[model samples]
Target: MQRQPIAEAVREDIVNGKELVFVDFDHTLLACNSSELFIAACKPSWLVACIDLVVRRLIPWKLTHVPHWYRLRDYACCALIVLLCPWNVMLWKRGAPDLFRRHESRELAVSLRACDPTRLVIVSFGLQWIIRALLSESSWRDTPLVATPNLAGPAYFSSGKLDIVRAHYPDEVIARAACISDSLDDQDILHAVGKGVLIEPQGDVYRAEEHLYLPLRYTAAAKYARSYVLDQFLFVDVLIVIAATSFGFSTLWQACLFVPPLMLSLMCVYELGYFENDMVAARKEVAPTLTAKVERYRTYPIGFGAWAWALVLGLLGVLLGWHFGALRSETLLVSAACWLAVLAVVRAVFFAYNGTATRWRAFFYPVLQLLKYGSPFVLILASLPGAVLVLSQIMLMWCSYLIYRAGGNNKAFNRDVLRLMMFGLGGVCLAASFRSAPVEGFFPYAITAAWACARVFKAPIMRACKTLRSRPARRSETAL
Candidate 1:
């Protein structure tokens, strides 16, 4: 009644030359719903949302039966998404269209290839250009497709599919033809055809009349893994770590010796954090990316694997650093022990207050990041390490501000700019003190004191800003 290889079903019951084979595009042939993936990839915009709502509400469900109306609606919807959405072109360039072609069923492809390309027709409500682009990548490039075009014309949807099929075949030939679809909406097409295959959303084919069930042989797990890893961008941090260490020391030898294991360990650490982020995303039911599925990140194999790999690689980096004379053995051992202790304490503190502590954790994360990325430099250059650390921290703060501003996070941008101003003012005062001091007379403690006082005052300013924000809220509550 139902089978794995579609070729077996086609050969056993049907005549490829005489009977036409109609395939539904979206969930039947492709692993994912192209429209869903496209919508997920697009950035949120109020204008686009309003347009989408208007279009959906105004377009009568009954109008799908009409040819020109359906075409116009399809064109309008596509244009609204492309023009009104803030990141429309970027979403497409990021391979929104390629999502359809990513996991084409090999067995289905084989079955379609076995049939006459002309007789095997793609009937879908999916946009024609996108479906054609997807098909062009596979052996089904020459296959005939009946789909919704970009311009106003006849478009296939619901019962319109049957009309397209009827136009392609004579009554005698249609009596021997077959239609394969994934939704109940296509039941009319199934009823009209002599034979029908009901493909479940998971891609197991069933005999429409017999109601047979078959096990699915394919899944998108591996594809999800590849896409998820690439999107996280762990390698960029590895490069930054290498550059930070090399720049700090102003020497390539120690950078070269320390970078390999350091890069590996840093990637593992970042990926461990990524696993945590993905776990939170899953718990929140926010699948922001194609691969943000619970099965992709939440299982013991994936979660445990990241932690174990990070620990092992971190230890390996320390050992390699000591062995290569990049760092002293005793120093590496002490640093490893302290690192473990610090991580345990941080985790305990972070979880103790639950969500309330998250803001503090976020603030400190970049500070800890600066220290971690600069650890190699600290080990190599004992002299002026403080100066290097201070300067790097100042640069990191400003760079983070620029990034936050670009992303439109005004709150973070303002906070980071305040921090940068404090650092800049302190640096100028310290430098002035050093310059003003007599060459023969050697007291720079006064300058250092001024710099320390400037840093200490920064906390009060931050607290004042927080207090100011709360004052308005407090007044409103009192009035209520």
Candidate 2:
């Protein structure tokens, strides 16, 4: 007794008057390497530095498992902080240079699509222009698209998303659909009619009555909704339980007993920051499929070193307590006043820089980009002794990730001030983590110094790349 083949089953289902709605995009309709397109689009910018990071940091492809319905909810639950931050990927497009499109334009434009024998519907919540442009340019124009119509106004991604799908495709007999989407927003599609395909490359062997799937595919709309996909409500239940248990057992003082929480926070921030940055670059399409590898993990033995030093100050408090000194001793009072003044001045200057300048434009702009971006560590530094730094880091990581994601298909970033920003932040965090007072004082000044050094080094790297690109391509002798 041998088993029947899968394709035969699919053909059988289709031939029996089952209206096959090949109702997903990305990996389903258009077949191209999205990750390859993403990286190619983002090339040649200083963001290439992040590429530099990924090249160095890429975990073996073996370990990067594709999260399906079950795992996505687990990941999303842990990413609660990342999700709460505001994202504005829309801005990256405005700032992008036109040259970005030159190298990274679509491969199989709409003209190349084969006619869909089955009814193909592209369900989406992204801007109509974006989907339209991609479709118009691709051979997929003949395929019907059932997305939230924004020919009207700004519709919430969540509000009418399900309604649009429901109104169009009602039952399995009316439409036998094969959903090739990674996000659970299409769980309606999964539950309603037929098979749900995961575009991601790795996952468990999933089974259902009519459903089948592949790995996750990176579509603009699907990527946005990926977390909400599947039986996620149950996963949420598990997370709430974890939160309750962590809260019940872990007091503020006991929080310092181990490194898992802080290390995890740092890992989350590190990944989310680069994730957003890549998304910003790849906003024209989906976010780039790459990671920024940082070696700062090696150097960062003492995160919140400033706070640790403050604890030593508390030891001074203990000595004073033993001697029965007043809480406001003259010497101690003066040190506290000076510390307060330094904090106010630093914060004011940071705000000013963020409001006005880039990291390098007339010196002040570089400072501004630094302060605006690096203000997380500033607040973290200011709110020492408590766990406010962890929360601040969480907020910045999530916010930065969103801003990075909102950019359009283009991945070009203006390199001047933000160039100053990368090292500026790294410098601040490095500084804050140093325990010595002199080292801490020296850290703030390093942002300016690092900006100058980066500007100088950037030129040589460009010259080398130009020389390489200028070399002529070698053609095969068979052509001659």
Query: Which candidate leads the pack in TM-score?
Result: 1
Least accurate stretch of 10 residues (summed lDDT) in model 1?
209-218
Residue pairs in steric clash, candidate 1?
Answer: none
**Against the true structure, what is every candidate's RMSD?**
17.4, 21.5
Kindly report which residue stretches of model 2 are placed more than 4 angstroms away from their true locations once superposed: 1-18, 30-118, 151-156, 159-162, 171-175, 199-480
Total backbone collisions, model 1: 0
**Model 2 over residues 1-480: C-alpha lDDT tens digits?**
122222332343333433554444433333322222222223222233233233422333334343222222222221221133212112223222232232222322221122244555676543333344445534455566765343323223233334566666665442456554444555555555565544431122211100111111111112334443321212221121122112222221232222222222222222222223334423433334542322212222122332333334333432342233322234655534443443344445533433432222234433433332332232122212112222232343344444544543322543333434543465467558867753223322432343335544665888999999998988988995
Question: Candidates' lDDT values, in order?
Answer: 0.51, 0.35
Error of 1 at 25 (Å): 1.2
TM-score of each: 0.39, 0.27
